[model samples]
Target: MNETEQRRATQLLQLARNGDAESLETLLASYIGYLKVLSHSQLDPRVRGRLSASDLVQESLLEAHRDFTKFAGTTTAEFTGWLRKILVNNAARAVETHLLAAKRDYRREYSLDLLRQAADESHARLNSMTAVHRRGPASEAEHQEDLTVLSNAIEKLSTEYREVIVLRHVEGLTFADIAIRMNRSAGASRMLWMRAIEKLREAMSNENHE
Candidate 1:
């Protein structure tokens, strides 16, 4: 965390702890995007419809706002990790409360057709990415393909892996930054990233074969 961020975080925590409502809201608003992305990545594909991501995000924000007291000794990694925990926990609760009460939807079938389509979409996205996304810039057609591949790859990642990847890679936090947000040592963050990459490679390979 930078000096400014550290100060702001400290201030927010203190305010929230003291029951300063607006300050708490401001603090949680700053982190809402990260929460939404985490929730999306964690959702099971088998489920669909009426799953309110925004509501879950709002709920998390409210809880954090109220319980900021418990979140003392703040570090950048711990902030992200705590946010992640809230999102994952909320998702599990949502599934149990909504989906489990009803019959299994079974609408999303995992089959050759869906897999091939996913692979094709992923390859296209990869080919289309800009200079930074897929190693380097590409021609217009390639750029579009790169985006398609990237999107598919992101969706294919497991929730846990996706959380780290989004924060560190997509959100552009450094390894140290990621470690702090994830509440892990730098070594663990590095290993998690390595594992995420390995999973991506496996996903890509499977796409190619299919």
Candidate 2:
């Protein structure tokens, strides 16, 4: 975030810390898109038909709201970090819940710990995509703000393109896995991802200019 935006977030943080419900609502509401991106990026597509990023985000926000009084964050980065932990836990639960409902044997299926680990890794990697854009103080805050911008650009893409980008970049899925999920040949998936990245780049460029 810019200096002005960071200051604004800090103000909101203070109000939230003081139990201002409206400020808390406004502060959390601003992160809707960000939480969506994180949840969507980490949610395994195998279980996504039964779960949704929006639902996960809602659950995370609800949990955050309930625990807001316990939060000690004094800045946006710290607040976001706390929220992300909840998001990952929720995501891990979603994976376990859906897989079990699908009648998968627990012994054969991936462990819940693995699910959480993957979610954590994916979250970090996705943020790294934005983090690489700059380096210095409050870089993480800048990373998040850039993610908001990047998320906006990603949303404008065609569903096909967006899906490819999410699987390949956000979720760190290999082209082969993406192909299996998308029901396309590996070569086709690669081509789609290429196109998706190109479109995303153009969208980001447009956003930068605007």
Question: Which candidate achieves the best lDDT against the true structure?
Answer: 2
The model with the greatest TM-score is 2
lDDT of 2: 0.75
Candidate 2 stretches with Cα past 4 Å from truth are 1-8, 44-47, 95-98, 101-104, 107-112, 132-140, 205-210
Superposed Cα deviation of residue 16, candidate 2 (Å): 1.9
Clashing pairs in 2: 1-142
Off by over 4 Å in 1: 1-7, 45-48, 102-210
Q: Kindly list the per-residue Cα lDDT of model 1 for residues 1-210, writing each as its tens digit.
A: 233333355466567667787766765665664455445534543443657556778888877766767775554435645665666666666666666657454324323244334333433323332244456555543443333344456557887687676666545568898888778988999999899978866765554344
Candidate 1 achieves a global lDDT of 0.57
- How do the residues 33-72 of candidate 2 rate in per-residue lDDT, one tens digit apiece? 6777667766777768978888888999999999998887
**Model 1 Cα displacement at 58 (Å)?**
1.1
lDDT (Cα, 0-100) at 156 in candidate 2 = 72
